[model samples]
Target chain A: MDKRLALILSEVFRLKEKEINIALTKADVGSWDSLKQMDLVLTLEREYNILLTIPDILRMVSVAGIVDVLREKGVALED
Target chain B: MVALVTGGGKGLGLVIAEHLLSNGATVVVVDRDRDALDALPTSVFGKCLDVTQPEEARTVVASVVKEHGRIDVLVNNAGVIYNEPLVNIMKPEGIMHDYGRFREAVTVNLDSVFIMTCAVVEQMVLLRTKGVIVNISSISACGNEGQTAYAAAKAGVNAMTVTWSKELGRCGIRCNAVAPGFIGTESTHQALSVDSIKHILQNTPLGRLGKAQEVAQAVATVIENEFINGVILDVNGGLVI
Candidate 1:
């Protein structure tokens, strides 16, 4: 699940796989603007088959942040 | 199966309603024009409705479900167009259109679709029927001359098609859109001059305008195909890339 989420984030933000740092928030990534944030939210929701609330979507700012949300939704992730 | 078509009074909407009915699905048609609704065949279930009226959408949706067990298909095909560019063509001193025209374009084309879809989808969820929605877009969705408002609304339909498919897929409902080019409908025949029509044909790869039946075939195909989801199927005859 982590691998899939990372890939989707990388693709949406147009970042190289190696450049997709867990600490890189939307403020850090040049491409992760508000519009791309919405795209990421939609993509993540579709990819994981989870419905995200507006608050959850707004809080999604980085890879670690996404992993936390997915985990809350009971999405099993690789250790 | 049961289906509902907006703007089924005339032009392409009428053809789509007939096509679905002929394919063994019962149909309910709604239109703002009383005259157009009256002209339909006696067998068709017709309603003279102005969808823009706030309460009409919910009332019509409820009535259709009450009469029919369920609506398995919905075609959001109601729309209007004004071929006025950003700059005034009719009067050089004024702008292309007043604020009212712009509001009317978005209201009729975009708002009506959103309202009707929500109303139908709510019932579909309650009944737990796997429903299908097909939105009729236009080639102008990409961009077209004198279609500032129409293009925006059609493009909004395309976006909703994709968004709804994702959001509603869990409920077993699927959504798609069809963007058509110039079609030889009664409205098109009356709107464009012979010389302008000739120019359009010359530019079209098929060397002729599309028939309404041809578009009906595409809409029916989408409804029949279970695998196609979140697709903006272009029925244009290669007019644009």
Candidate 2:
């Protein structure tokens, strides 16, 4: 897992790095409810200094999905 | 620039639309009055919309985004004013007031402002476009006799203007409001008679009613000045001061 991505995931969902996976989704994670989804959005925005619209939010459903969108935004997840 | 002015079909709204158009923005004006929409020039796009409906608010924002690609500014100028003393508003027998009128006043003035601003700002955030929102509030926001609904709603507008500015400013968006005092418009004419206008002017320090153009200029100033945020610029000829 990319270190920054793991950091955000852990901070947003209060999870350990070992528990997270690319396939992990809001449905799979008990803490990833709607409110959590919004919180994650704000957290991602604050961390990345990027803005996501409703459509962008709808597309980012899972950890892998978030990684993909972050890549599209040119965020350096590896560091 | 792309701008949307609610209640653009008539009165001050119309003037605001014209000002934006003249300033080189692709202006979209929405109003519930079909006749008012028809009155707009061919150069401007006019939509007959009742913004109080959440669905309509969504659709308008979506279409504006699709067609214009971005909304640079939003002027929430769609509103109405009605005045009837509380005593006359107890229902069933009051000659001066009706509950329906109060509901309509708030719905049009305040509720629509809330719905439309949220819809527009959502898209603005998504686009990552720095935008400006100017809400049309009123001096009655401070409070006025027989204007409970109008006062509450306009005051709500001012409050939201400040709140959104703080919340969204980090996203490169700014929210501000314009509170006009006795602007000359068809709506004003409907709300007050000549004698009432005269009395208001007499009490006003400036000794005159404000013009819609003055209000439009204040709105434009807030929109242009990037550093200004969360301000309720009054265009009332220093009435309250």
DockQ of 1: 0.01
- lDDT of model number 2: 0.85
What TM-score fits each model?
0.73, 0.72
Each prediction's whole-model lDDT (CA): 0.83, 0.85
TM-score of chain B of each: 0.95, 0.95
Candidate 1: which docking quality band? incorrect
The top-ranked prediction according to TM-score is 1
Per-residue alpha-carbon lDDT of candidate 2 for residues B52-145, written as tens digits (9 for 90 to 100)? 9999889978998998899999999988787766543113244345679788988888889899988999999999989999999999999986
Give every collision pair in model 1.
none
TM-score of 2: 0.72
lDDT of 2 by residue, A13-66 (tens): 878887778888867776564445667888888999998766667777798888
Complex DockQ per candidate = 0.01, 0.01
Error of 1 at B72 (Å): 0.6
